[model samples]
Target: MKKIIICLAFSMLTWHSFAQDIPVKITKSELFKDEYKNSNIVLVEDDGSGGVVIVRSYAGGIFSSGYGYYFEHYDSNLKLLKEYEYQSKVKKEDKKIYRSILGVIMNGKEINMIEYIYDKKLQSVTFNALTSNINDFDFTSKELFNMNSKDAESGNSGKDRDAGAQMIINEDKTAFAITVDIKDKNSETHKIYLFDKALNQKIDHTFKRDIKDRKFIYENIDVSKDGNTLYLLGKVKTDEAKKKKDGGRYQYELTRITSTDEKTQVFDTDEHYAASLKTIIFQDRLTCIGFYSDRNDSRFKGISYFELDPNSLAIKKSKFNPFTEQFMIDKYGKDKDKELKNLRFKQLIITPQNEIILNAEEYYEVYTHVMTQNGGGYDRWTYHYDDIVSAKINSDGAIVWARNINKRQDTSVYGNPFFSYTSTAKGADAYFFINTGEKVRKIRKDRIEFKEASPKRSNLTVIRINENGDFDYREVLDDEENEVPFMVAYGELTGDSVFFLGQKGKKKQLLKLTL
Candidate 1:
């Protein structure tokens, strides 16, 4: 008998499969409490050991008071190990407190915690009173870094920094932090600081740019697993050729920064800025992937991948339009308007094997009608149609397969046409999970399609594809009604049981399956 087994570590279940199965049924379980209902949860493996660590937040005491974030350690069996919480005050006079937990890092034997507090009194729409604190904690003792009473009044440069910080640990156990400065006039100035594992400061570096009218937006940063190299991702804005009456420009440069030989190298491209970019670094290759959209035309978007030499940090466009020519032609059609040909890529994914998958949602125009009093009749109204498409490309940017997921529909606004496409070792599949309306559509190697319905049909769906690029299975759980399966994660062939993260009413639960 072919069986699939899934395991749930904490409130979340990571699915792994050993074999393949078609038309598999997913079960559900109640693993534990739903403590992180409103807060985002980052899952970290336990210090190269076994187990998991969760860093989360709680609603502050008073309204508009912000959040009180905390960290909890758990074992492989989902047993809680320890929990820690921290709070911050924004200003001296404002009794109200607004706090946020930015990021968390785990070194060999210690856990590093960082947070930010915003005060209303010393605040401006563009700037506010902010304080950042870093703490190092072990099982028995805790040490606060750069936390001196005298240092508070000095307004030391670190006190006013932004709360969005990232931490990376070196091979020697030292830690480094990179944070963006929103208060800087240039908005392109970013701060980088290095620290020992004990949270002691080492070297402080700053990267500043002087492009007029263009602000810098920091996207993400990472340190090499060995800790010798640091990678910074951001975008630079440029003034539009022509200014609008509303006071904003129309051009920008997407930028990347890499540190080597104690010096930083910058790579700037004239691509439109995007909200986020994902970077993956292997032993010899560094890959950067970002989804870009043209502001002048919302429909113009695409995914661009850059391969950089780790030592020199020089970027060469690795794979542009990896998807096949036929795939693109079939989706857009030869007769479509030129603007349709320029549709933007809204979603993209890179597989472990280095293959790039690009998904683009078509764009359309919307027209509104203004009623005329003299005409005694309503004016005609018209709207544009946007197409939804998905395409697969090889490592060299050659299209492997392409399909149009949506045509034009009058009942709905094309539902944003962009579908979530990720590479799985089992194969490739498209996922769509909206709250209360979750559904998993699986396309197998044989071109067979299977779907698992979401419970509560709450539109919230979780889909998992194994490392082999094949559809492992899917889980749909809802508490509004008690009609959930026993487990959620059922591998394709390892075992008959399924593993799942379940939600019942107000509680988040987990369960194991034995079908």
Candidate 2:
């Protein structure tokens, strides 16, 4: 047995990854109630001191789904620790309510559900829900912000409107922040609220800016660990750009929003095209990365990366293409036109040693014939995946290593959940879980391909990448006969094991894999 170790900033977990038959303990927890059939719920992280604390709540009422809220907590072993129901003493009509999750905050032993209540008639929405203790669950409510709704007739934000408010809490729990984005067509505005440990508002501001004819398309926004600054990654889309200058139609955009100042920055590469620009915060620095394609082409021909200081908006590293020439030749041969395009960047993993790993899969779309009730119809759908390429960027911004797990596959169905893999990084090595078709064999081409099968089968495969950039592959759960529904889950790496909740039809199955 080989012991696998992971170094997490807040905690640690150890597990064994053996090649032999590893017995897994599966525990099926039936969480679906009659009302919960909707599946709109909340899950809180375990403090990991005594017993794991889990929360299950309803949007409307407790029993009849009328008003107020319901909460239930359980231990690590799925044993009910206690439960509580918070409602108005003077109950009114069972009208519907609109709400959205800002985020969850864990202070001491308390798990706070920072949420907002929306009202169309009123100018602003209300924010509340905080748990001081299990029994003393405090309920604080207030109107937080005011904005014009997409539909004016309703006079409210829409009785069932959820603006998709996001919440962020600092590691020490001394600070908390809630952010909501209002998108209009291609343009968007972000509403941010900063709070102190006592749930007092420290700063409240709204960021709305237009760049002439270009609309600011917001990506992922990060609130610095200290809870003082917000780094927003967006794209400016314009169709009027001169073809000789602008590659396709968009520019890489980023905005730093603070109390006193707001700075918008753009990355100009003359004719280089960009797709799927994303930001990842590590240490105190923010890294923005995505794939670079040819002019007017969305298919990726290369990759681009840069590091920036969130506080000063200074470029710590000039933009660099870490995709080496040797890597391209090795994967796609010397034919530049036949090179690996359509590389879908799945994730960015940074290690404790400042090693950056970029994980991507070769994905594209194809139009084909399908059987319809009337006759043969030409339909369009996405053809996902082949070969997962993992590149390691060194501490000094140098390309250190690039490894890959060869897989040529496409599902009979559509959607990303059926194609892409989920991963967890523990120290230098990382693990991935994705469904694989029959075992891959040796091949010589631009990319590897899987042999044809009568009926495609999905086997949950586990891929491990070691510190030295070595690769290991194994099938953890096999469904070759296609009798079981394919399970796709992202598991948490706990102490010496992984805990995952997989959905099989309407039921939820929990598995504890101890290496």
Candidate 3:
């Protein structure tokens, strides 16, 4: 195993005008020594104390050690306490076809590493939980579940749909849930599991009744604090829907699973279609917020909110608010084609006051064919992360205001990790952190745009939107003052503070923003 290096120095950055009104404190650690630049922060968790635990994974190939990880622990004062190198056990001789780390969890006195591995020779896929004590740091692996790869490959027909395992952890981190879907030509099967923070399995059941007429894809899952109940939110597709199409032909469904029975609610109305939906248990109530579109059309028209009975999955209150005029102008200016499509849900924050701050981004992919000299061709894909639409919903389920942030980013040159942004909320104000070029262009009186910036000369910018939907942005960290570039998309938000890891070449640093 390679001995990991660590060096840390702390400094505070001064904020600009608007941030001064509410005091945005920036604490940064100087660049530390690292051997691999192909690393990204996967988790930044607060250890019950004021300290934090940061975990990053470094890439490895057949020539080098297999994929490995670095676990760094820091005190509340931003000083490094300890670092651990989890050398990958999978060598080239292992012949593992595919592997991915789902998430890294830090519980009371333990660290849980949840991962998925596919074995080509055995034709099996396994979900394993690697557990280590905080004091001992020695890991033990346990297989939580397994599936046959043949069933997954034969059932999956599209690129967007994933037939493997999916994991979700609740906001409080008390429990987590995992769902796996296996489908074949004749039948389909679904498995849902709930586990406590200590990796104790609470509920394990197979769901297969709802797959005869339609296919269901679950996007969100949450387990109760006690790990006794499970909730799932996803989209359902019926035979009426055409191939390679999206819109009203599909409907959103909420399933509540308990130890005894399961209840479901389909959120399909005659007037509008739910383009996207995300759910959270706030104040002991099952609440959902998402975007809606006019009948059958995939283009979004407004925001949608619903309050449902937690146990029965019954809708108690519902509201659909159209986009405001100012929001349309902010997004489209004077263009005749004002349709908003391909908006994926990014963040949904419920404040202490019971208000909701919702955000989504315009994202899509374009694939092109490149020909070779032998009359054969290969497919190349480009990912686009574009404009962001943000809105605020009052406690009564009415949209207070909606706004759009203009930006354009693609993965043709730079990677997708540097394109999208991260968000956190403080009181009534919502903050979005992104990386932009040297200058942000102000095209309109109140609108500004963020263009693609190079990694070396990027500006870590923060856009703050008040409760009234009025927003202002400024550079929190400029390129000249900072040597390491911040990966805004990889930030971890805990309460009012968010932590980001900045890395450039063989140097990396930790950045903390107190909003």
Top candidate on TM-score is: 3
Residue-level lDDT tens digits of model 2 in 343-450: 776767777786777888777777776778887676657465676777777655556766556666565556533456656566777667677666656566544434
**Clash totals for all candidate models:** 48, 8, 0
lDDT leaderboard ranking: 3, 2, 1
lDDT of 3 by residue, 1-515 (tens): 32335544445756545544546788876567665556778777787788878788888755665677888777776777777888666667776567777777777878999888888888988889998876567889999887887755422445235466778787778888777766644444567888888888888877654454235665677776556788777777756553424346666778888867887898764467776678877646788888888744568888888989887788898888888887888986743335688898788887878788898898888989999999999988888888988898987889888988999877764455666899888888888999898777777655678897876568888888898888888778788878788888778887678888887767677789887
What residue runs in model 2 are displaced by over 4 Å at the alpha carbon?
A: 1-17, 20-44, 54-97, 130-177, 181-188, 196-198, 212-214, 237-249, 322-345, 362-387, 408-419, 437-442, 445-458, 478-498, 513-515
- lDDT tens digits, residue span 228-254, model 1: 456666554444423433312332223
Model 2, position 245: C-alpha lDDT score: 59
Error of 1 at 303 (Å): 3.2
List the global CA lDDT of all models: 0.42, 0.56, 0.76
Q: Superposing every Cα of model 3 onto the true structure, what RMSD results? A: 3.8
Model 1, residue 76: C-alpha shift (Å): 3.6
The local distance difference test score of model 3 is 0.76
TM-score of every candidate:
0.57, 0.73, 0.87
- Candidate RMSDs in Å, in order, are 10.0, 7.6, 3.8
Model 3 compared with the native: what TM-score? 0.87
lDDT of 1 at 189: 55
Clash list (residue pairs), candidate 3: none
Between the candidate structures 1 and 3, which one is better when assessed by lDDT?
3
